[model samples]
Target: MQAPVQRQCSHVSTCELFPKFGLRGSLRVWQVFYCLGNFEGCARYRLSCEGRAVPASLLPNGRELNIDALVGKP
Candidate 1:
């Protein structure tokens, strides 16, 4: 018999991809992977239209939030 798999979120409540806006607003890690299409593909995801790297956050328009100003020069 095959062993059962234990699926869990790697970055739940840690990563900045999802903000904690009440109970219904935040997203789980699985949701991030679902929207991203692949687990290993987030680094390549666009941080900004002007080409910049920033912390992860999703917008109401279904776009990645670019908070370079908030993070401020790594």
Candidate 2:
């Protein structure tokens, strides 16, 4: 039997939020749902494709992230 292919966002390596996702366990869900799956539905992916500025706080579900809180910043 053949192994199933895994689809991931092409910009994951360059994405600012990609690395941050690993810092918090809760953020992993976003990576699993968007970075590794359904990347086409990601807001960041869509913005990048359109040559627009993708905000670091933008989430795949079109929500803004309070990353500072997640990372213990003031």
Candidate 3:
């Protein structure tokens, strides 16, 4: 028997937010839930498909992240 194939977001390699998901343990859920799981539900993926610009701070859930605040930047 063959193992089931895993479905991942095609934009994972080009998505700016992809690399940031690994920096913190709490952020891993995004990768598991969106990047690897239900990518169709991801806001970034949706925007990309529509030919819209995806902000670097945009989360998969359609929430904008204040990256500077999280990273302690001015």
Ranking the candidates on lDDT from highest down gives: 2, 3, 1
Highest TM-score model number: 2
Local accuracy of candidate 1 as per-residue lDDT tens digits, 1-74: 99865443343354364343222334444344533344333442334433665445554234555455334436
Stretch of 10 with least lDDT, candidate 3: 64-73
- Model 1's TM-score against the true structure: 0.29
Runs in model 1 with CA error above 4 Å?
3-13, 18-22, 25-37, 43-53, 56-62, 65-74
Q: Where does candidate 2 have its weakest 10-residue lDDT segment?
A: 63-72
Off by over 4 Å in 2: none
Q: What does the lDDT read for residue 64 in candidate 1?
A: 57
RMSD of 3: 1.4
TM-score, candidate 3, is 0.88
The TM-scores of all predictions, comma-separated, are: 0.29, 0.93, 0.88
Per-residue CA lDDT of model 3 for 1-74, tens digit only, reads 99988899999999988878887778889999999999999999999999999999999999999987656579
Candidate 3 lDDT for residue 46: 99
**Each candidate: what lDDT?**
0.42, 0.92, 0.91
The runs of at least 3 residues in candidate 3 whose Cα sits more than 4 Å from the true structure, single-residue gaps closed, are: 72-74
